[model samples]
Target: MSSETETFSISGPSHLTAIDWKNTYHRRCVVASLVQGVYILERDRQQNRIGSQKALAPLWWNFFHFQLNNMLVDSADHSIFGAIFELKPCLNAPRFVIAFRGTLIESGTRSRDIHLDLKCIVNRLHKSSRFQLAIHSIQETIGLAGASNVWLAGHSLGSAIALLAGKNMTKMGYPLETYLFNSPFVSAPLERIKDQKVKHGIHIASSVVKAGLTVALKCQHKQSKPQQDDPFVVLSYWIPHLFVNPADHISSGYIDYFAHREKMEKIGAGKIEKLATKHTVESLLSGAILDRISEPLHLLPSAELTINKSDSTNFRKAHGIEQWWDPTIHCPSLVYQYRY
Candidate 1:
């Protein structure tokens, strides 16, 4: 057997051999493979090697009995950012999956992706053309297959795109099942602080400042309280599944963000926590400057946060999409549900 085949042979569970959709691990492994397929697809295209076995779209999708239905191309850089896979007949799986590839720093799409990453950091990703295209593709998919039959999955920057798109669709009354792997959380690296008391103190201070700012903004603008139908409030019920490694600074902030909210509630500061959790410093600043409220891409109200407890000390390995599918890793998770 060729080395390439050997390398990918044990990548993960095969859908042809086992159909266990009820298994959370099995579902994670399959969805993660589909996301990896998008990465390989883009890599193969960039290298001018489309049909190589390194392209796991065919090998993995064929094993899962899914066929590529469409390629989501980025109009700015002409890079393939995502794909639509439809299950073949006689398969027991999601009818359709819209999977996205994350940033490939070493590839041709590096510049375009890095630009989008910057946009994400500033809470301006929603205005980007790539994200607009993603939203349109998802809308078209739902129109054709209905939202219940479709699943959304992405990694890193791709996960941010998926997240924004999912939020948009959910507001329009189409809640999707989303899987976000190592999604970037733009914030200070509080998770890196080893001293628990110091980290907690900083978190409390940050939350107080944010909550105070929100109250001041409301008083200045004479704006009424948010209604029950407000998009952010409505979004609290549509929880996405988030996978992160504690060692990955880019994504680990989510752990701190959600945990701090719980701590605030425990101390009878739920009101401050509520306002603070709904807005980020970047989003608040952008909103004040532009005279329009902007939602931060990473400020999720609810999520099934899965933290991988793998012993790998490498940043690249910790933030990698492949780790989600690694059967040997330990992933303990908690559901963070927001209450009004």
Candidate 2:
């Protein structure tokens, strides 16, 4: 991955196919999900909780503690989705701090950060429900486990889910603070939100989405872009020829796309395959779909927080979010047009 871009999650039209996510977040999640899948969702005994590395309580502690330390943690998988969330420590916030990461639909290198290559990897790359369900599981676990001091956070795909969950909980009168990292798509449909419900105490948060100029440089390389029609066919060609730097995979992506295209064509219409193979990363980067423009599925957060160093009023765009934050402390919330 590049210097500033960090990876997390995704799935998309212009995404790569040969990207290996094993060293990525999905690996951690699939392992955890398998633990839970076969797990007897039963609580561990007080003594049982002591030594088991696979114990659920310790896992929660690790999950939350990672957040407390401002570190990102991965999510579980079934169709094998992945996510990242940073749980901040709650000194006296009066509530628990819970985090949920979003998915990337084909954004980065096979084993790199989403921030570096947003188009190489892919997952629930939109504001969709299946992604929402992944976070819903986390919520259910949080309540059942009695892990208090929760503040929800998400990086990319999970960012949108975190925003919506927090906003919905707020409207339902549930006290919560929402933070979305550098998300691409708008979190929720505007009309669905209520007026006073969002205004009272539940605050909407987000940051501005920005991009680095070099991203344009990477995409601008014509020789580096793919020229194939099928991803599966491309993989057939490149899988045997491994490269040293992951960045090289971007140029090699054309081959992966070709193979993936052929594979999908065997079953489906190869719609995404057709789209992925046709364009150069440079072309997409030149437009709105930058390979590193605020995480393809991430949201710029706009939340409120009063730091002791500076008051919230002093902060212009108090909750304005950017792509830099792995799981930003600020996020966007849907506030509908007010009605009398």
> Using TM-score as the measure, which candidate wins?
1
Angstrom error of the Cα, residue 245, model 2: value is 28
Candidates' C-alpha lDDT: 0.84, 0.31
RMSD of each predicted structure: 2.3, 21.4
- With a 3 Å backbone cut-off (N, CA, C), the pairs that clash in candidate 1 are none
Candidate 1 runs further than 4 Å off: 1-7, 10-16, 52-56, 89-92
For candidate 2, the lDDT comes to 0.31
CA lDDT, candidate 1, residue 150: 88
Q: Locate the minimum summed-lDDT window of 10 residues in model 1.
A: 1-10
Measured by lDDT, the strongest candidate is 1
Model 2: lowest-lDDT 10 consecutive positions:
238-247
